[model samples]
Target: MKGEHILPLSQSGSARNTHIEDHLDGSSAAIKVIVFGGLDGILTMFAVVSGCAGAAISPLQTICVTLGTLLASAFSMAYGEFISCKAERDYVESERLREEREVEEKPEMEKKEMLDIYTNRYKFSSADAHDLVELTFRNKDFFLRHMMAEELGILLTEDDMTPVKKGLVMFGSFCILGSFPLIGFIGNFLGESGSDTSRIIGFTTTALFSVIGAMSLGYFKGSYMRQRRMISALMMALNGVVVGFISYLSGLVLMTLFPEASI
Candidate 1:
């Protein structure tokens, strides 16, 4: 799964924060929703606004297009996440059942597999590996679960990867963080009508805001992923830049095709 993200089973944090999460039941999945949804919201709206401004599209049209895109994207993200998560859980369960059956029907084969894995993959001594496998196989359920977790990278608990929860978080966070770009437009409409600011100025300001949004996501990423703050921030900002430039080029190409539209 190229470009796909995998959540870790464990994350380190301050003792106080760990205790807080223990009580609150926080999931690393939430970090995915917040970081991705937040970044998408800010970046997409900013790009659309910048593109509309570049094309000299009317303010009213800009509002319509931006809002349309945001609303559609929000829905898509939420529903898509829900479906994907559900599918993932189903697939994992299906595989778990298959593994369970295999372990039950072919205990010796599985023991050998476990022994080989421990010895070859993990470099455990042959005697130790055999003993470990024997101990593990004492409980059928535990043996199956351990095999899946260790060999297949399955999350045994899956306490946090709820589809509905992830979907709602994605949609809600996207809406909340996505509104930043629109805030500027809203301010304009509330005051003296949105004046025709220079395209360069508008794009510059919008890009800066988008970069800030990206950095915010990156901060969350660093906190959750236990990575360096500056690197994550710069990487996110770089992604935003790529999106913005692509959008800008698209606008230019459209303007070139329909020269009269820019009129």
Candidate 2:
């Protein structure tokens, strides 16, 4: 029994599902990767950049801090996202194995459950329910897949997106999207001879990039669900505002605590 239960699920890992982009919800993972990654990168770098500037730290030190943030945050977000998505996938796979066991042990009960679902939730007539259920029953693979989807809302993975891939997606997008805010600072650092104007450019440029990314995400998510677009944009922008406030406040505190230290 245990061996049978484990076999199907174990094999599913190797099974190819379908295209990820076939469904509207397909881009959810990527959106999260981009939005959150961009927002976090912008806000954090903005704060550090501000704090370093406030402390009157040299441009070299500021770059060091900003660059360090880019690397550290990207790695952290990638690892964390990988773990999160993988955990959910693992849970669903485990449940699938359990369901397979139940279906094998009690085929009649499983069939009846499907019949009930179709008739009650889907409003399928009795005749249709019987035919549908019977069709699923004759094929163990289809039966398991149907049961998992209809009853559990757990569809087979639509794509071969592994945790590693998801992580890389996040890491790559995050580094790129998040780098927007740092662009001005970097540009000034490279173009100007270390001056107050360069510092001004750094913060201002960071703000502009952060705003663009945050607002774009807001609009995308809002419109994605056919929701009130304005509300969605405002809400997403609010997240950036909160993060920025906190970052700025932290920088302020840092500057306050060490008036003499050039950190």
Candidate 3:
């Protein structure tokens, strides 16, 4: 213990603050939804376009099909996000209320639990632990918060986004980022119709745009996660390419199996 060099309390607090700031800076529910949701959007649209191209569908038909899938999927993702987040928030709220009830009905037991946590987990001396517990229990709200964190491992923060806001973010991310792959086909369909070369060009452009979008999302995610941005970007792009290729092959097989439906 002589050379352990334990940090002073103030310095330890500052270090914890710095760590929290670094981790929380770009890491929010909305940002997470945007990065991951956008990746989902781009890859899904890319796969859809690849499938249509492999099936030799008309450019106009491809545009229509992709739009249909994009809108439907976005709506589904948004609604699902809303319901799940709402459920989780509700659960946390319920647990907080339950903890408050326990604190009110069983004050001695709650105090004993807090004392045990401080003395056993934090290695506080018995007198210091008792003093800390008594001080904490003086404020009912603060005591409840402490119990929630130490016992339930839940930190209820007002800064958290509402379920509705997160859901809206998800919907927008899915729609806007997901539109990358469909843009090329729409433009090609409007300008030049019914040509093999134009179809090939459209497919090429779609794939390019989708990869860019996926890489951008990955880079943003990497920045927040403190990882190598280029590596993350490349990995995400690779995943999209691999999945899109498989989807394209599946489409080709479907087309082959039902040549009559190709018309």
Please provide, for model 3 over 30-53, each residue's C-alpha lDDT reduced to its tens digit, 9 standing for 90 to 100.
787888678889999999999988
Of 1 and 3, which scores higher on TM-score? 3
Clash count, predicted structure 1: 0
Rank order (by lDDT, best first): 3, 1, 2
lDDT score of residue 43 within candidate 2? 67
Error of 1 at 55 (Å): 1.0
- Per-residue lDDT of 142 in model 2: 84
lDDT of 1 by residue, 181-209 (tens): 77766555545334555434545666776
Candidate 1 segments whose C-alpha is farther than 4 A from its true place: 1-25, 123-125, 193-195, 198-205
Candidate 2: tens digits of C-alpha lDDT, residues 1-263: 11111123443433444442355435655665666776676666666776666566777787888898889999999999899877777777788888889998998999899999999999999999999999878989889977887776665645445678878987887788677667877877787766777677766776676767677767877776668888887776677667766766676688788777644
Model 1: colliding residue pairs: none
> Once superposed on the true structure, which residue ranges of model 3 sit more than 4 Å away at CA?
1-15, 18-27, 118-132
Q: Is candidate 1 or 2 superior in TM-score?
A: 1
Candidate ranking (TM-score, best to worst): 3, 1, 2
Report lDDT (CA) for all predictions.
Answer: 0.76, 0.73, 0.81
Q: How well does each candidate superpose onto the true structure, as a TM-score?
A: 0.81, 0.71, 0.84
Model 2 scores worst on lDDT over the 10 consecutive residues at 1-10
Whole-model lDDT for model 1 versus the true structure?
Answer: 0.76
